[model samples]
Target: MTAQVKYDDVEVGTEIPAQTYQIDRMNLVMYAGASGDFNPIHWRENFARKVGLPDVIAHGMYTMAQGGRFVTDWVGDPGAVLDYGVRFSAPVVVPDEGGAALEISGKVEQKLDDNRVVVALTARSSEQKVLTRAKAVVRLA
Candidate 1:
């Protein structure tokens, strides 16, 4: 699917709108079941603290997906993204009562040939940077 966002219409250093996602323990449980990565650090608070974490944490890949969603939603086509990656810098600590919030924002870092642009992403949870070196290469209409 071609992106509704046109490459010619975009500019380097353009800011994509930001988004915030509410992440709860149930979301982690569902992610674990879907990914088969039921590591206790994600769902078991006691085990997470035992492992030196503040509390139950969200999966790294799950957090990455949220960043991807932020980019794709902006361009208006998931298939428009040719490449995406992130380095996990911190954990999204999910508390028992209110859970956690993942805030994501992006900017167009570079405009490339072939209708592609490099999108730089930032992901934060609990006022902490959760993902670093996050970027996406997207082909636009």
Candidate 2:
């Protein structure tokens, strides 16, 4: 694990190292079992298309969790996250052949009083659509 990022060391526009995640049908099925979100759109291609989706998509929360992991991993502790939220801008379409890949990146957006910083995040799938627009308030040591 990386050492904690001190509040004094961060500044607006500081970029966190980006991470890439791959999601396949099996992973989505596992997530469904683990999260108890059996929404057909996440696993059944026909159901997804019937619901207006191009293909079976990964769960929004699963994508959000990956984004959260990016921040927590960078900060070295999950407790450093004071607050986090995301707007699901688009679905992550997982192809049956090669699956889907998501690239997530974060930037320090602002510095706040009392050892806090705001991190802005952007997640994009292979299709180039913004999958998640997320922001988090992190308490630095």
Candidate 3:
């Protein structure tokens, strides 16, 4: 897919629109059913605590996907993202009462050759960063 944004019009520090995605237990259950990652740690708080986690946690991939969503929505083409990666720096603790919120934003980090640019991402939950060194290399129109 071709990006709607033009590479020539993009600046090195341009900010992508920020987005916040809410994750609840039901969401985790649905993702578990779809991804077949039925780890008890993601769905059972008591089991998670027994295993050393503070609470039921959202899947790391789920958090990372929010970052991807932020980038793709800004570029206007999911297929325009050539490369994406992140390091799971912290766990997103989903409490039984309110679940969790994943906040994502990106900036044009650098302009690459061939109409491609590097996007730096930040993903946070409850003021703590969940993803670090997140970036996407996107090919723009």
Candidate 4:
């Protein structure tokens, strides 16, 4: 685990290290089982095509969870998060053989009272953003 981030030491515009996460059919299946979100669009390509999607895509919540991971990983504690949200801008298309790659990075956008900071996030897949306006407020040590 990383050392805890201290509020006094962090400032607006500080950048968090980027992370790349891989998602595949098995990941979607596991998420479906755990989240009860077994939507076909997340796993079945033909069904996704029928529904007007380019291919099987990842769940919005799963993508959001990745955002959460980015925050928690930085803060070094899940309990540090006070607020987190995002806007799903596009789908993370999952191909059968190679899986999809979610490239995520964050920057400090705001510093608030009570030892908190807002971290702005960007998540991309397939050369396009999958989530936008994503931010997390974290209370640091």
The candidate that achieves the highest lDDT relative to the unseen native structure: 4
* lDDT by residue (tens digit), candidate 2, 1-141: 789888888889999988898889999999999999999999899999998999999998999999889999999889999999998888899978899999998999999998999999989997565655589999999
lDDT of model 1, residue 87: 95
Error of 2 at 90 (Å): 0.7
What residue runs in model 3 are displaced by over 4 Å at the alpha carbon? 1-3
What's the TM-score of every candidate structure?
A: 0.96, 0.93, 0.95, 0.97
**Candidate 3 local distance difference test against the native:** 0.91
Residue 134 of model 4 has an lDDT of: 98
**Clashing residue pairs in candidate 3, if any?**
none
Better of 1 and 3 by lDDT: 1
Provide the overall lDDT of each model, using Cα atoms, as 2-decimal numbers: 0.92, 0.90, 0.91, 0.94
Which residue window of length 10 is worst by lDDT in model 2? 125-134
lDDT string for model 3 (34-75, tens) is 889999999999999999999999988888887888888888
TM-score result, candidate 4: 0.97
Candidate 3 has its poorest 10 consecutive residues by lDDT at 1-10
